[model samples]
Target: MAQAARRLGVQMACWKAWECDRAAPQSNRLAMMAGILAVSPSWLLSGIGAGPLELEANDRAALLQELQIASAEAVASQKRVQQIVALLGSVPVAGDSP
Candidate 1:
């Protein structure tokens, strides 16, 4: 966000204000911001032009499947890590009396 603010040549507070609708970007800044955000200037100004890409139904389904698989893998990995931690907790230290 800081980097983006720098690129837009505004302070972070100013950027945040625009984001929160507490302030609005000037005309020139609007174009720069649109470029930085990869949206059309018209869209940025009035929400009337090319905006973010919309995923097709098939693409959305594929992405959903991938995310689900990654989530399941993460759960499995977490369980394995917890098991390892429990095992380590029971192991005796090298210099400790058994």
Candidate 2:
């Protein structure tokens, strides 16, 4: 839900409320959410179409592997960004151009 909220540019609380049935997403948001979940919008809205999509075993495995790689890359990228910020912080600001 946190991931969904982040991707949707909504507050986590709002997503939680949606999940908990405290509120519902607008029609436009329904399509976006369905796309994110890989389900038919109609199914998400009313179980009118296929309820939820299921991946084949091999496809699921491949997706899990891809997710793992992406997660690792994201962590590495964050570390690099933190290192760059620290390095920049160590450098003194110049009052005049050379």
Candidate 3:
């Protein structure tokens, strides 16, 4: 579970809370969790839909595409953050003034 949580980029306590129904991840994380568990997000949330094993080939392909898009977006976002940090590094910090 610790490894799974780390892979999910969540703390162990947050993962445990999800396990205990004390918290719920947002919808984006729902999709990630489903992929990790080989289930559908609907099933992962409410146990009311087919899981990955039960999905048709088209459904599987669609999910894979969505995951790919999300992965690309995450990479783009990370690059933007790095650029912003680099830009911030060049800004002058002033000394405290009375």
lDDT of each: 0.93, 0.87, 0.87
Q: Model 2 segments beyond 4 Å from truth?
A: 59-98
Candidate 3: misplaced stretches above 4 Å? 52-98
Clash pairs, model 2 backbone: none
The candidate maximizing TM-score is 2
- Count backbone clashes in candidate 1: 0
Query: Model 3: per-residue lDDT, tens digit, 1-98?
Result: 89878888999999999999999998888788888887888898778887657678999999999999999999999999999999988776688443
lDDT of 2 by residue, 1-98 (tens): 88988888789998888888899999888888888877888988677886665789999999999999999999999999999999998887798444
The worst-scoring run of ten residues by lDDT in candidate 2 lies at: 89-98
**Per-model TM-score versus the true fold:** 0.51, 0.54, 0.50
Better of 1 and 2 by TM-score: 2
Q: What is the lDDT of candidate 3?
A: 0.87
Which clashing pairs does model 1 show?
A: none
Q: Report the number of clashing residue pairs per model.
A: 0, 0, 0
| Candidate closer to the true structure by lDDT (higher is better), 1 or 3 | 1
* Residue-wise C-alpha lDDT for candidate 1, range 13-50, written one tens digit per residue: 99999989999989899889988988899997779989
TM-score for candidate 3, residues paired by index: 0.50
